[model samples]
Target: MIIMKAKIILILGIILSTALSSCVSIMTRTETDVHTISERDTIFSYEQKNAPGNQDMGIVYPSSRTFKSERRLYQRDSIVERKYPDFIRLGVFESVGLIGTVSGESSYGTGMFGIFPDFINLKSDYSGDSGKLFSGGIYRIGVGEWRLRWFRDAANWTIGTSMIEFLIPSAKKQNTLSSIFPLYIRKRYYLREEIPYIALVPSLGIGWYPSQYVNLSGSIDIGSLGGLNLRAYAGFAAGLNSQEAYQVRMSNESDKSHTSVFPYFGLGISFLDFVNIVPETYKEWKDHEHSSWNIGLIQASLIAAGADSSAVAQNSETKLFTGFIFKIANASVALPILNNQLYLGTSLANFVVLGFGEWGIGILPFRVGYWQTIIADELSTEPFIEYNYYPSNFLHIGNRVNLRISDFLNLGLVMGFASGETSMGIGSDITSQYGAPISFSRAYFGISVGVSDRIFFPDELRYNR
Candidate 1:
């Protein structure tokens, strides 16, 4: 046992040392074109003309040592508006929120449902004691209305078509594809200027075909307008003649066409700025320095935790997990002490242990954290259904030291701490009267890669010019 413990300590020390020592330099060398101008080409110059009487009056001048000759270059600032291709207008949105089956058939499974997206499971078993309230997350892809140019200067209304909408619900055994090819209209009220930092948006969607549904919601968006932003919303959704509703009706042998009404409230991220329709006059000088709104769009990590020698010897093994952090929006903050910024987003993680795997979503407070050039720290709270155990809430605290490879990519070393509950028995058997439970605290270490904005380096504002 002593030798085994020593090995574990040594291994951990080596991992930490390697991670800390792998920092990458953020400096880049660039070539500049030098222009030579002759004295005759000088745009403007002046020479002192000694006045006839003053020249003989013994007027004195400063020593020649104080005078210096220098070459100067001046570049005029120009405003440029980015134009998008007519056919390439696209948008991606993701949201997480609480859903309640307000008015639906109690005997029928009224949870969220979807189609397409192979990862979604169709059949659902709602027999468990789960209540009417559950959590859900959605992913949407939309096209059209690029920047609402048709609205002219108003540009406050957007009419688009969603190509796909996928829904994942908690308390349900399977995932579902909600709709495809739905017409949506959104109206926004700006609280400030053209690039307003805050706006109220109300939207409606109507779906037809495979499943019929109506979604109505109102949301408040914060952060950079038209680009990456954070969204909070409350709305009502109803499925009439949806496939899942029909299944519930058929299973119950009832003539009534089942319908489900879900009232939900949640937060999400919107990446509508990808269409880049903001006018040049509304853009700030720094806006021209970056082509994208976020530092990173997507991040993935491979992690391992809970390495107990006794557990490994017993064949339980250490837990291996894969995590993904999706960027919703980010903004630079003005602070006195440190280089700081706020990140608003969500994360999804899959944990595998002893051949069993489970998925967890971190929504709500989303991901709120600070990131400097090379280091980042974040906190998240999520509900996880662990392998061989019931659903439990877990708190995660994580840190990362990033090594930037380029303006578009970064690799990082990650260390995290998780606090939750672990079952002492096998499977759901831990819930039995004879089962035992214990507190769970594990340290996870791994590596992550991000498709992000320029990180781990000084801003390359000169390159943009």
Candidate 2:
């Protein structure tokens, strides 16, 4: 629920920024080229400029009779009078470009924190295992303000940090023995990863300015994530001097990149200037930087020759495999392939959610063929896999749906039976499939809180939203 709130906030910020940017771009565009008036002499009204100043300006004016243009007049009787614009025009996106933006933030005080009790099931039988998800650890807090940046352009950077502490719901710790010595420890999942930590993020990116405040920013950020990233931090200020303009700032920094392609939405400031740096002026109103959210899905999957979640006994006689559930949270990475049609992604699924809490997250890095439409229609097959984390082996089959909503938001609902299995020697301390034997997994569901689509414009076609 907390993560969902943060997503809502960031999405809103992106929306606000896009809207404001579009307004500024249109408001600032030089609607009519000063063919008749030079910038140097533009100080006075075009009709009022004296001949000497116009002559000194050395700018040439097009002959009104020679230039071709649509007469703005609503054709009435023979005579014509141009119609005045009802309102300014705002730019819209055509194809897709990138934008980059940066921000600085600071919280007022210690910040907002809260807690709630919940239920957790670690065993296959949900009834017997359902326990206090947080017998005592139920605690959450919104840390200090964090600085953020949106990388859309070629040269964009962002840096932000927030101090946060997580009281991971405490559950009954498994005990060794009472006869030998009273000993109990927290579950490996909640213990190893839970701690009072600080979120750190810094990134660099560059994108094309499709419009003032509308940048299709493509950024690569490396940062820490903690306590549902506080929704957002925003500011509004006004400036009229040459150095400033009335501006509003919005920013975002998600360490987890939803799609390897376009995954970040940063800021939107309105009522300012417009320029493309390159093709500085296309001299076309059609070159609009679409400032809208795309709610779409990423239909893709992965096949890996890797160690499964199940471990193999090096002795051959018996495998004293470590009993830990592979985390499926951060095992997949969004690969925005060509036409934004293909995505190269990997997500780990566990048949059983054990003490270690079925650890996993999406991962990137795939062959170009995996991303390209090498396979037609995506086959519409149910793709699935089972990992033996111990020996580092996997038996994968079928096809899976990459149901993504926002550009980075995805919900992986996998339902299928595995048809094959392969094994590999485990390299100690692997991020996945470390020391467990492969478990045959049936239909499984992985819930994700980050972006997941190659194209960020799904909302245009899919959502009632």
Candidate 3:
């Protein structure tokens, strides 16, 4: 029990630290006003050339200077035109690549996925009830999207799906929140000339939670909001619900959902910049070549933990147990928000104490993070830090260096502090018969091996690019 408490505290700390530190925004937009200025200058020059009575007006046209300026402008325009094909290639291909994505949205007034029943006809229509409107009700849906762009980045079609799980009050009141499989397709159009870049998105999809419900939604994405894309969406949903869906999941609840046209509105923040990438050239697109894929494969570690042992019923000083740890998979992903050099990943590993006849596995995905590349090439090195939580009530912090052997594999040497209850069963001669709670801390070393990049799509085989 003591070790379990420690594990909870450690997990909470990790959550708080990540949430606080990850808010720093690093995106800076580049200026594209050069083309606008060039257009205005060209128009002004044409007007001057066509001015009335210019022949008699003795307008001393500096022919040599004018010719040079015109030549330079023409060359600049030609260069820009030459890059248009590259820009088209980039927009059509970049989003098609599998890349890290994170987004969130909330709908108010309308419930996209039955967030709140529009009219609860339980005791009668409660649609106008102010209490229901401000009940702190929420339905959160998150999805990872696979998007395809076409026609010179002018349009994109996205297909995405996400599992539905309730949180907070929703979970406590509902006995079962199951079969929530949401699939959606959204279309986006970039408005390039807008001062504050904007995207018009119209989406349609279905939420299949035992039954099918149609969802129609639309949002306007404002590209510049403190380096984050701000999305405002409002939509309505048409679906059927059982009587159980109407009952408010609350301590003292009286509600029923009997409405099909549930209206919703919410705001979201995304790492996706649908508008800005529309103007990117092929060379600029190469920077994102490595962004989509992640390091894949499992990492196994031969570990030892300190614990009391005895050949008979007598106790002995602490010593290391020849245990083994095996994680199913390990992968490094580019952090989508920062879109910088930093990367984050996770490992799912299990541990077995051979001497104690005890075993433990990670309860959640163990974080394997910190991949700021200090060096790149055939011989690559990056800093690595890992935080792991075990079902046996063990919490570990592993700090190490990662060396990339090739494009598909990496190796690391790790040494970190481990603290928690010993997973020693009572049957073991060393452990107490009652399975007394055992606690210990030790510094341990482990080696990590895994695949480097798990490609999602070919770099070149994207839409006719």
Candidate 4:
């Protein structure tokens, strides 16, 4: 009853959240392009006089726009109309991003810690033995997780740690143990207008829980198959315990011990940047270098040209972005070849590219495909197809019914197939993680959050003329 009630509550919460999401708009206002203006002399003169020099501070400009233009290279203080739409949107993601940063950095140092004794007991129902045996040992498995992520520009660097315990059942007794991961690091780079991003992780460290041992591990996350994150970690460990605590000696059996090569897997919100992490130093510098006069120049020029500043701000153009999506996801992988055992996985989709015409490749190192909207209106249907290869090889094809919950979020149901096998999942393919094909599984349900000025413009903003 409790579980059912909890599930009901969860469903209700999702409904409420989705309803609220529909009301939230991803407001966007384009930066005024002087090139669009018939008169360029005013802008040129302002640039000439206010350009920064080695000795002259001149007039200041918003540093946020420093990298806003590719053509304005080498011009850090380029002044243009402050894009009002960009800042008009409520700082929704900024707050969430800050929360992630804080939780990630402090989890390792302030989380739970303890030491306990472990016991192994044999079951009495064994057919091979009528007697029960028991053994005891001391062990420590730090149960906690921490991830510190840096999301700036189009790059992300995430460092994290997780402690997981494993249980081994033998003929005589059952033993419990856990692995201590001191460090895990990943670097992600985004490709504009593409869906496949790139990610790399390197590992180096030593662990001393079970015994004095050196550890080395690494893996790449492939993020194309949908709203799941997947990764593999393998390394060699010296002085590790043998798989079998006791083995009977046979005529052909040798007493030699083999080095341990361990493979670890993880699934969950792998690696993503819900919001950009603005550095304090950069923020301070930008704040100190503010130039109110440039803003005045822009407003005066517009007014002189018979334009209203408020109108210019409100009439800003909309920007369409086509770029590679970088994402982190919650996911899992089944190691069928190993032991048919399921392992949790953390993944980074480094190169999920979304280009013009809504084309891209993603779901990681295993899949490549295309997505298209069949119908777009008050309601929309998008169908996507991709080829997947990994634990299983197959083709995935599916579609989604998307209803605007708000400008920044979507609620939908997505279902599809792989070759003859079937797989289903729900999510919008906007962020690098959620808006891809669901691979390796058969079914899923999801929600997607993103940025948009509004889902449906107010009647005043829509002009039939």
**Per-candidate alpha-carbon RMSD to the true structure:** 14.6, 23.7, 20.0, 24.4
What stretches of model 3 exceed 4 Å from their correct place? 1-154, 159-169, 172-183, 189-202, 216-238, 241-287, 291-302, 307-397, 401-412, 419-440, 451-465
Ranking by TM-score: 1, 3, 4, 2
Q: Give residue 201's lDDT in candidate 4 (0 to 100).
A: 48
TM-score winner among the candidates? 1
Among all candidates shown, the one with the greatest lDDT: 1
Using Cα atoms with residue i matched to residue i, what is each candidate's TM-score against the true structure? Answer: 0.50, 0.24, 0.38, 0.28
lDDT of each: 0.43, 0.23, 0.40, 0.28
Give the poorly placed runs of model 2, Cα more than 4 Å off. Answer: 1-157, 162-344, 348-393, 401-415, 419-465
Ranking by lDDT: 1, 3, 4, 2
Residue pairs in collision within model 1: 114-176, 114-177, 114-178, 115-177, 226-273, 295-452, 295-453, 296-452
lDDT of 4 by residue, 107-183 (tens): 11100011010111111222121221211111112211122344543334544333422211122121222245544
Query: Model 3, residue 363: what's the lDDT?
Result: 29
lDDT of 1 by residue, 217-310 (tens): 8988665432455667777777655434434344443444445456677666554333323443244434443322134334556665534322
lDDT of 3 by residue, 308-402 (tens): 44211224354443444555334444444443334565543344332333333442344544444445442333454444443356665665556
| True-vs-predicted CA distance for residue 362, candidate 1, Å | 4.7
